[model samples]
Every structure is written in C-alpha cells, then in structure tokens.
Target: MFKSRKNGVNRFAAATATHRQRIQVEHNSVLDSEYPFRLNFYNKPPAMDITIEEFELFALDRLQVLKVVEMAKIRNRSDEDYKKDIQHALDTYLPMKS
Candidate 1:
C-alpha cells in the first residue's frame, strides 16, 4: 500500500528540491543548447528512432500484456488461470519472444 498524502507531499517537496539543485548545476555548467537531449528529469536517454509500424506493434504488444494483467487483478483469478491467460496472450501478441 502507498503512504498517506502528507508523506507523499513531503517526499515530493524533497525530490523537487533535489531536482532544482541538479538543474542549477546544468544551467551554470553548460549553454542552453549544449545540454544533451533527455526524456525526463532523471536524465533518461531519449528513445531511439522508431518507425510508425514498429511503434504500433510495440503499443499493441504492451496493450495485450497489460490487458491480461488487468484481467487477472480485477477478476482475482487463480494463479494457474492467470498464468495460462497471460501465456496465451503472449503467444497471440508476441510470438517472437519465445
């Protein structure tokens, strides 16, 4: 289970302060244009170039997996049933993974 709102707020404030320090370092050390492109504040690398077809395929694969996970959680399915359902989903959506 997650923490209460008060704890969440305190954690958020601490994280934001830490982020501001890193931003200040970046701003002082490099020109605006010189800073490397990143996807998020944690400095995650940007995703490699992907074609529309590839993107669609990846989305479909993820959706299939997520749907199975949701069904298992929502229905409170037995472990064996969940495993079989997820395996079937994987076989249908991501045959290459095997």
Candidate 2:
C-alpha cells in the first residue's frame, strides 16, 4: 500500500509538470499575438527599441488624455458630453490620428 501511494504521488507530480509546460507554451503564444489592435496596453511591451525620452513622452501623453476621460466620467456627464470631451482631449494630445 505504501509503494502504491508513492507511485501515485510521482504520477501526479509528472502530470503537474507536463501541465505547467503546456501552459507556458500557451502563454507565450498569447503574448506574441495578443490583441488585433495596435494600441499598447503594456501586456506585451513594444518590441522595437525606443529612447528613454520618447518612452516618457509617450507615457505622459497617454496619461493626460486618460486623465481627462476619467474626469469626465467622474463628473457623470451625458454620453454626448463625455464623447465631446474625450474627442477634444484626443484631438489636443493625439492630433495626428484625428
């Protein structure tokens, strides 16, 4: 009975190891593909090298735009008002796209 119990533990360990390896592979694949959108959610960082200054600039720009959107939400503005505010914020911060 002792020997059978040990064998069972060993089998369970081996199964757990295999499961972990499968999960690692799946995780890597998901990270590689991520979402279809080009926008960065920081789940998978930008692949290309960027200067520190550029990174900071990008971070701050996005932050300010998001802050504006958050403020609008907190104010409990109407949908149209929120949209207008967000559009203005995006236009000011991210003018090229619009």
Query: Whole-model Cα lDDT per candidate?
Result: 0.74, 0.80
Q: How far out, in Å, is residue 70 in model 2?
A: 0.7
Scored by lDDT, model 1 comes in at 0.74
Q: How many Å off is the CA of 11 in candidate 1?
A: 16
The digit string of per-residue lDDT tens for model 2 on 1-98 reads: 35345445577788878778432323344545766444658766578998999989888989999999999999999999999999998888777762
The Cα RMSD in angstroms, rounded to one decimal, for candidate 1 relative to the true structure is: 9.3
Q: Score candidate 2 by TM-score against the native.
A: 0.51
Using lDDT, give the best candidate's number: 2
Candidate 2 lDDT (Cα, whole model)? Answer: 0.80
Which residue ranges in model 2 land beyond 4 Å of their true spot? 1-15, 18-50
Tens digit of per-residue lDDT, candidate 1, span 8-46: 457778888877843234443223333444433534435
Off by over 4 Å in 1: 1-50
